[model samples]
Target: MMLPTRLQGSLNNELNDGETILWLDQPIASRMARGAWPIVLFGIFWSTFCAGWMFFTINMAMKTPADQAGLFAWLFPAFGLPFCIIGLGMLTSPIWVRRLALRTVYVLTDQRAMIISRSFGKTHVRNYTPEKLNDINRSLNDDGSGDLIFEKVISSHTHTHRNTHSLGHGGHRAGGGRSSRTRTSTTTYGFKCIKQAKQVHELIDGMVLASKPVAEQD
Candidate 1:
């Protein structure tokens, strides 16, 4: 199939001598924008809280004499800094997603599916043949754009722990720790936020069927 001129050069570089492009498209920006709400809310909450804490810690550090501040006083602002940065990232994740949609491209050929993404000044290309795909499924959006999932997507979650210990001079110290744990995963790989999803699914199904042996088809 004919590809957009902008994508032709990149895809041509990846194609083998005889590989043919069956489909090529980019993900819909609105769909990504819709998917970004949860992240935006989380970012807002995280950034707001972390920024407040960071300001408070710095204020406390300034109020106390350097000699009397102790190691914990200095550590407080240091610890808060990373959290503040992380929160800022979370807050801006939606904009990043939109930018990513602009830089990402998807393609399906008779031999395989390909995803080309550029982020942080780096380009990543992922390829999947029919054999490499499993449990292909579709999720449709209200706008008729949808995602096709081919592989499982696992989400990582972090658990935090707070410990309070009594120090020698009628004083108590508080410390926090965090660990990551994974839960059940959902499907991840495949075309994301494309139009006419049902047609695309059927086309892919036909391709997969045609690739199987004649005996398997029966």
Candidate 2:
């Protein structure tokens, strides 16, 4: 299938001289959004509960006298602010995921596969060679839509930050505490939420097997 004009324009510069496009498509946005339902449901409950708790704290603070309220009144409501913000973000996860899908395009070529994404005023193109596509995994849905998994990349992320403390009695002493967190995430690359996934997966699988050296194939 021909790609959208915008996608074609973005992809033209990356193609080899004679590369042939076997399949091209954008993921189904609505289909992708379906996966976020669990997050949305949890977010709804979380946001409701946090908002209610924050409001209750405010009510209590208002009813209490200033002398009794002290710093607890101010601290109580502020503590819930971040959770409320986080809950709001989760509530809109589906909408954000769907928007992300709309800006993504997937392509299968005679020699490689590509996942193109447009975000933050930039076009990013990812290409997977036959070597990386050797072990293709596929899952098809009842409606003829599915995902082709070509690469499983395990990445490690690290975040480092420092903590500061205050000293007593007009003497200032400074000490630094460092904290680091390491996380591993497996990122799957492929054509996701596309129609006729079985056929597409088979086509790519055959090409992958054929691309191997004669010794390996035998």
lDDT of each residue in 54-146, candidate 1, tens digit only: 889889988999789998887878887788788878777778888888777888888888998776766678888878754587888776778
Off by over 4 Å in 1: 1-8, 65-76, 155-187
- Residue ranges of candidate 2 with Cα displaced over 4 Å: 1-6, 67-76, 154-185, 209-218
Error of 2 at 27 (Å): 1.0
TM-score each candidate.
0.76, 0.75
Angstrom error of the Cα, residue 181, model 1: value is: 6.5
Q: Model 2 shows how many backbone clashes? A: 0
Worst 10 residues of 1 by lDDT: 173-182
Tell me how many clashing residue pairs each candidate has: 0, 0
> Per-residue lDDT for 10-51 in model 2, tens only?
888778899897778889899999988999899999999999
Residue pairs whose backbone atoms clash in candidate 2: none
